[model samples]
Target: MLMKSSKLLKLKFKHQLLMLFMALLTGTTMVSAQELTINGTVVDESGVPLAGANIVEKNTTHGAQTDFDGNFSLKTSSNAVLVVSYFVSFPKNQTTFKTKK
Candidate 1:
């Protein structure tokens, strides 16, 4: 009688521990939002592709450069801000709004 109760208590404790471990594992994997790929082309006001432009994720070291056709691709969070710059003469404060498909 007493022995059976003790065994049941131990089993319950083990089951609780297993559930806790699973929760922790799942929490870590779900802590971050899925990264998104942003593809765009840097163009001048005159509608010409600005090749060799720098596209940087604001406040982070992650960045990319435009190809000869002014095409660039970056992987970042959905709410990230990108800083684009070409030659020093280019206005660095030029702000572009995000577009959704």
Candidate 2:
């Protein structure tokens, strides 16, 4: 009976450690999936900032517009694709950018 009790205690300790490890792994994964902030500037062919350019995350409604200095910032997941659009006197121009992992 004493030997069996010791073995059961060891097994319970091992199970608790396994559960703790799994919980830590799950928390790390959730943290990685959290949103990340992205910042960039839109520029025209003349190396000038393009103010009021629209920046949108691909496949999602999250977006932001460039300010007067042609700078914009938005939050998205890792390795996201962004669609950028701007128009002046001519037709609207569009481009795509991919965020780094």
Clashes of each: 0, 0
User: Per-residue lDDT of 12-87 in model 1, one digit per residue for the tens?
Assistant: 9999999999999898777554457789899999999999999988888978999999999988766678889999
Q: How accurate is candidate 2 locally (lDDT)?
A: 0.83
Best by TM-score: 1
Q: What is the lDDT of residue 91 in candidate 2?
A: 51
How many residue pairs of model 2 clash at the backbone? 0
Residue pairs with clashing backbones, model 2: none
Per the 3 Å backbone cut-off, how many clashing residue pairs does candidate 1 have?
Answer: 0
Listed per candidate, the RMSD to the true structure in angstroms reads: 3.8, 5.3
List candidate 2 segments past 4 Å from native: 1-32, 88-101
TM-score of each: 0.67, 0.58
Span of 10 residues, lowest total lDDT, candidate 2: 90-99
